[model samples]
Target: MTQPSRRSSQADPAPSPAKLARVRTVAQDAMRGARWWTLLDLERILRADTEFWRDLWAPSLAIAAHKVGLRNARSRLDEAIDAGFHQTDLFEPELSAAFGADPDWQRVIERARANVPVPALRLTAWPEPGPAAPLRLDRAEAHRVPQLLPRLPRPGEGAWETAKTLLGWTAGLWRHANARINAGDALDVLEQVANGARYSCVEYSIVLAQGLNALRVPARRVWLRRGDYHDGIGQGHAVAEAWIDDLDQWVLLDGQHGAYWADEHGKPLSLPELQARGHPARPVHVGARELMKDPALWAAYFAHASVSGIAWEPKGFVPVFQDGQVLATERLVRDSADAYPRLSDLAIGVTAIGGAPAVELKPVHPYAVAGSWNGETITVQGRQRFARVLDREPGEHRAALAAVTPYGPLASRELRWTAS
Candidate 1:
């Protein structure tokens, strides 16, 4: 037998300075028994705090630099364990915490070592299923569009009529073929709408979904990762899914791409095939750089293009009202500078008003006067506005004020009305 060539050994590659720093920080944190390693803890930390990232930034940059040279980040991480610079437990602290106290980790490692060969790939050989059953649109649903349009004068100016008018307008927009056409050509047409400041990717997706739902077309917001469409490395995409009843299957439509359910040959493609062609088996991490750039693109991707249904920021921050009372107010502050000016002023007013025990106020707006009661003091944004209680008696007290904004009345009923 030929003698084996002498193997040349080089010193193990040194970790990048950044990588070493990260490892040191993580190691230090782990030593301290901090809960920061847990996913739930991480999420909580991200939501309630922002400064944590500042602390981790240096380490993250270092880790990223080390990972840059590695063919596969995961593999490189594993190699670090083999080289004795790092332990597997360092990477998966959650698992270590779960099983380190017992022999579970060893048992798991042993079980994994005896792994059998994976089964061979098998094609789905079944024939296409029959077409789906016909779905009937109800009168209420069918007439939903017609009702949405501005109607002629009606008998009563009832709230139901107003709601019906609004619904009718919405329905008309959905039922209109042009609206459908606009959605069909969303890739091109939507940009114009965005330019007009009338629509966004999220709004467009919602409009499409709502339109379909109004027409009795079952549509859902599907989330998935698009591997190819990336502004930068490892940034995936998202989209929507609609259930086509006549086709007896779910259809993938790219509201952003303006592509219908058909392929190049105009043949309808199944959900699986569509996903295989566009979406990937694994999701790429959506980095801050991608989000900070054109958030609308990502928003559109998540709202209309995703296959996993885990889209980000689906709802616009609209306040919630329950039984003529404001339950909660939500506002989406895009830029801090824009938000601070308005919010700071409101905060000051609230502080000043709430500082007082009680005071009387006169009507400033017509809507305000209608709702004013004898003694009502309204608390808004931490500020208090008092209204006189006009009909205050031993057994009864009522305060009224005009409607404030669209949510509810302005004044509170508890304050004594001091008429001038």
Candidate 2:
């Protein structure tokens, strides 16, 4: 007993160099991404409620649905949902549908819908779009975006996935031909392509852009030119870009190649972003067969030497042949306001229910509606369509709805009402 009592307290071992290095790298990455400055951000930081923690842990939460066979796939997905990877739409359609009825999966979707975070909103109000020019939203008959939308294959969820699916469908419309024939509008182009007319990249972009517009996603054709475009030797290439409300950024879609570009994090990169980064892009192909066989060939096509000038066509329906009607020059636009002047020109309908404190919100354009009522944040993503009914306590209710545009949320005109 005397010998045992002589033992001294033990000290903990120091962390190994490898462990210290990994920790430093992770911390550095987190700090670089936080970029917090505002007073609200400070409070969130103090409360440890910033999305930084969620963002940091997102990669580890990624579920490889492909690794598991069809038999075990459902259980694996259930496990993933229980672990907090709520992005079920990211999964393959077959995989998700095969086991969507599971209680855990259904619960996760319900929870995600209930806890939808508020989008960034403008304080102006609904329908009173500011000084910006209005977006020429496609008439249902004008582009046939409605008819074509359901016909198109939407394998995954979200705006980005739909754009990629449309790109693939557009690229497969016809074989590539250098012929300069007029493809007319997107519908006309489809009709002609079906009748054995091979078109160029211009037709591909035209169809892709129009297809996205039908889905309430703003998009435009991008005309890429070589530095010596004036020589008229090599006019340039044509591609498309769509404004994804989910990512809140313009993502390049090459319908001609059935591909799109992304950064290290799999975030789709706009054409200008690719140019700024010396076109170090990772191409994501959507089609069963790639338009460009060699992956390395894509970088060369988008290189500064190959594509020096970038121009965008005006929104709405424009004859593919009349593309040159709009001026073409060297311009690198990343700002959503500049890229899409009419983004805020959204069509919204607010209707009151008889003698009730509730109002029905109908947004013509697709995407969710986020806003506040008496300082309480609310975001509504309807299943039937982009419409929702909001109810508040009986009193004078001051509510504002924000349209979630690719350029960010713009506030709508404030609605004032008294409920008894």
Candidate 3:
């Protein structure tokens, strides 16, 4: 491996008019997009490439602007730091220098420094045996899927877009009412809904999950409750999540309200992500319909979002709970850092050139995954959990892994590293 050379910013001359405009344009877009990393990188670029050290510190400038009471200058920097920003970023020297002087900025930094990072697998040893069987659930009957095909979007429509369309359709099925019917599954709910039956949030989740499963998109019902659930707080919300093959992550869908929460970049969020309290999710509705237009109102619902469990059926294996509830609480979590796995949990490592130059893939969670490393395909499922090694050259390499989900194969999670 070779090291790239570096140039000193002090030796660079002043920027021309064109370069100034380019820098400003980048700064403007970074702020408008609410992508915190881009704004940070812009600060580094300005400090490294030209004499304008703090000129492009857009977020920092906004924070300072807020303190000065500038007209229409409400700094979302604090909110950005509170949500979506990582603790690893709190230590950036440029960031420290930019906001270190202000006492108010220092408090925000301190709070963000305490934020939890997204959980990823860090294997200390090779994977052991998983459950005797993968968690299987009752899928929408194939014969009944044809009934839903005509109502869905085109076959090749994007995963996220298709999901949103289905959410809209399911939500508009019937008016929400707190009535319990002796329905067996989502299909039963749908049939009853057509005959003038109004159901609760539970039915909304079931129908959405079934709808997605019918379309070959991996989906499951999730129950959210407060910590005082057992004490009869009577606060809970049922929603469904679908594994988007393009994003490689599960996104929450609320058919009850015809709503889903997304970040500023329009990326749909999972229940766990919303529980992380990192990013302020914006409420989005399907089609031209408007719902939950207020951010505060949306955040209030998810503020106490404690997941009770996932809704799935175990084929050969008997679950602790018979109500088809697979606990997502502390009972199921191995790591205290995160409540649950947001994406497919995987452990990947590479051997040195002297050690035969290979990459080892380990799928940790019980969910089945199909992966490819350096032109090799690997599949892990059920008790068949074992490290699969792929031969690769002693250079930069990349791998793509996706869960062979209940809905189908989701988007692949990409991994890249240099093998020396």
Best by TM-score: 3
- What's each prediction's TM-score? 0.23, 0.47, 0.47
In Å, residue 17's CA in model 3 sits off its true spot by 87
Residue 268, candidate 3: C-alpha displacement in angstroms: 2.4
- The best-first sequence of candidates by TM-score reads 3, 2, 1
Give one digit per residue, the lDDT tens place, for model 3 in 1-420. 121133222323446678767976786685566544444444434544433332234345344334434433324355445444434363355455545666676667666666655333222233223232233333567787777666555534656767888888888888878887756777678778878989988898888887777766667776655433333433566778776766766688888878888887887887767766665678788834565566664554454443324222222222323243543443333321243343455565554334343445555433444554434455543323323443244555455654453334444456654443
Off by over 4 Å in 3: 1-156, 226-234, 278-280, 293-298, 303-339, 342-420
Off by over 4 Å in 1: 1-195, 228-238, 278-420
Ranking 1 against 2 by TM-score, winner: 2
Rank all candidate structures by their lDDT, best first, as comma-separated numbers: 3, 2, 1
Score candidate 1 by TM-score against the native.
Answer: 0.23
Q: After superposition, how far is residue 111 of candidate 3 from its true place, in Å?
A: 60
Model 2 lDDT per residue over 252-334, tens place: 88888888988899888877677667545788888766766665555544532112133333332222222344343345343
